[model samples]
Target: MKGKKILFILSGSIACFKACEVVSALIKNGAEVQTCATKNALNFIGEATLEGLTHKKVYHEMFESGSYLKHIELNSWAELTLLCPATANIINKIAAGIADDFASTLLAANDYKKPFLIAPAMNVNLYLNPATAESIEKLKKRGVVFIGPETGLLACGVKAIGKMSEPAEILKAVKEVL
Candidate 1:
């Protein structure tokens, strides 16, 4: 991924911390990464941490000054987009054409002709919900690649699916996508 430009989106999920590792790996391997986060995601992982890793501001608001058209610019800048620790809410909103926030709006602006990928993270039951399932199918049909919510112990203290794929696996997927 040397010199590849990536736009990484972080949604609310406990697994959001893992995205830091993903970003670090990308940078360590010579890719340029820019991050956008949901408000709830910032709650889990501080904006400074993201900025510190990427050396760029963490964008979270669609209407923020000097960024009214940032979504379009970000999508246009990226060679690929990665939404790691993608929450059920973000997935559903994207599938439903809701661009209510910077992250979702940026996702909405994506042409999908580029490689866009998501790594789901949520409770097992929520992941399996029919609505969420349908949303996944919808995105898949639109040509979005899903990494995983691999079967394993979850943050909710139960062993099942909905665990975010590890950073190494995510990096592997990103490489494959590129």
Candidate 2:
């Protein structure tokens, strides 16, 4: 999509580093990208790298200067919102309707009419949790799309189904949504 605007919302997960590759691939494929990292996500990837790649300011806080309504602005600017390496914590927050952080706020303010994709990455225990399962179903019913928590070795040193999908796979999913 030449003029499509894709907003990548990264959450705290070891897979956050892979998002850089995702951004690069998206830009190379002719999609405009805007990246915003959750507070915990910043712990893995720096804002400087995100800003440098997208050539757009990376938002992490609601009270950051230069915008009185960053969430609304970002929501309006995005054609599709994609949350890569979506953490179990962030997923729960979104499912519970929490909007305390910039990423969560944007997600909360997003219109369901637009495409919303989430790629979860967590331990197998968390992935298999009943709560997480229910939340996934609820989000699906609400029209949210999921990329993958592909089966593989996890950050916790366990072999299971909680790894983030490969960047190519995620990019393909994005294309399908767009």
Candidate with maximal lDDT: 1
Pairs of residues clashing in candidate 1: none
> Candidate 1 at residue 176, lDDT?
94
Give Cα distance to truth, residue 131, candidate 2, Å. 1.6
In candidate 1, what are the lDDT values of residues 30-76, reduced to their tens digit? 99999999999999999999999999988998888999999999999
Q: Per-residue lDDT for 21 in model 1?
A: 95
Give the Cα error of residue 31 in candidate 2, in Å. Answer: 0.9
lDDT per residue for candidate 2 within 1-178, as digits (tens), equals 7779998999999999898899989999999999889889999989899988889888888887875597898889899999988988888878888998789888888887889999999999998888888888889989999989899988888889999999999999999888
Instruction: Name the regions of candidate 2 deviating beyond 4 angstroms.
Output: none
lDDT on C-alpha atoms for all candidate structures: 0.94, 0.89
Model 1 scores a C-alpha lDDT of 0.94
**Which candidate achieves the best TM-score against the true structure?**
1
